[model samples]
Target: MNPNEELCLCFHVTQRKVANYLRIENPRSASQLSDCYGAGTGCGWCRPFLKKMFDAHRAGITEADFPTSSDYAKSRSEYVKKGGGTPPPGATPVEDLPN
Candidate 1:
């Protein structure tokens, strides 16, 4: 996802926000990312990406591996359709998706 794209769609947490949080907050583990605006706590789609970012930080890499925003949102919509997760009330709807 792009820096401005919503990585955690359920809570509207952007990739930039998570990246900054990972850098500034210096969380000890991937799970600690939840404290950064309820990121992966909702539909759970972004958990892997969050973990990926954390792992990269620990490895001293500043870059992250992520799908394009469209691909990510499309996958998320598919996941939702398959009942992989249910987004919270304030989350971006599966049908309406991404900002």
Candidate 2:
């Protein structure tokens, strides 16, 4: 994922922001990331990614190992199908999101 890409689309939180939060806060679990500007709270679209980041952070990984853009798109599609709000303008399209 692009660092500037919106990981939590509802809150417009970017991958860089989440990574920074992880480095600063040293949260023990993915849920704790919600405290960072309500990252995984809204719509829950970013939960999986949050967990991935959290696990990576706990493992002392400094490099980003984000899921493919298509994975994000598939997640976003399911989120919207379940009544979550639409992704912001310039967000990745659903066709790109699905597996």
Candidate 3:
């Protein structure tokens, strides 16, 4: 193989690029990864393979095991406090937190 040929025809992502992202960023989820690396933003054709790589990067057996950006954001003390969960130790008002 030439090793530089694009794999995800939709996104023009390549295997080496994906591997580099896994090495450099250590992203937590496919969505987070997409935000940083633009993985699944095209025609959704590379989703399966991208998901597979993302899962492997996170040491997960499946993508479902990973957290969505919303999930992580919602699970934060800010959302929990809004949802009625007690603020965590050293918690600050959402407005006071850095934007």
1 or 2, greater by TM-score: 1
Q: Per-residue CA lDDT of candidate 3, range 16-81, in tens?
A: 677677668777776655653455554444456567777776774322232343333333434444
Query: What's the TM-score of each model vs. the native?
Result: 0.92, 0.73, 0.49
Candidate 3, residue 41: how far the Cα is off, in Å: 0.7
Q: Write the per-residue lDDT of candidate 1 for residues 51-77, one digit (tens) a residue.
A: 999999899888898999988988988
Clashes (N, CA, C under 3 Å) per candidate: 0, 2, 0
Candidate 2, residues 1-99, lDDT tens digits: the string is 888878887677888899999999888778999988778766677888889888888988866576776677676888787777655554445453333
lDDT of 1: 0.90
lDDT of 2: 0.77
Model 3 scores a TM of: 0.49
Among all windows of 10 consecutive residues in model 1, the one with the lowest summed lDDT is 90-99
Which stretches of model 2 miss by more than 4 angstroms? 68-71, 82-99
- Candidate 3 yields a Cα-based lDDT of 0.50
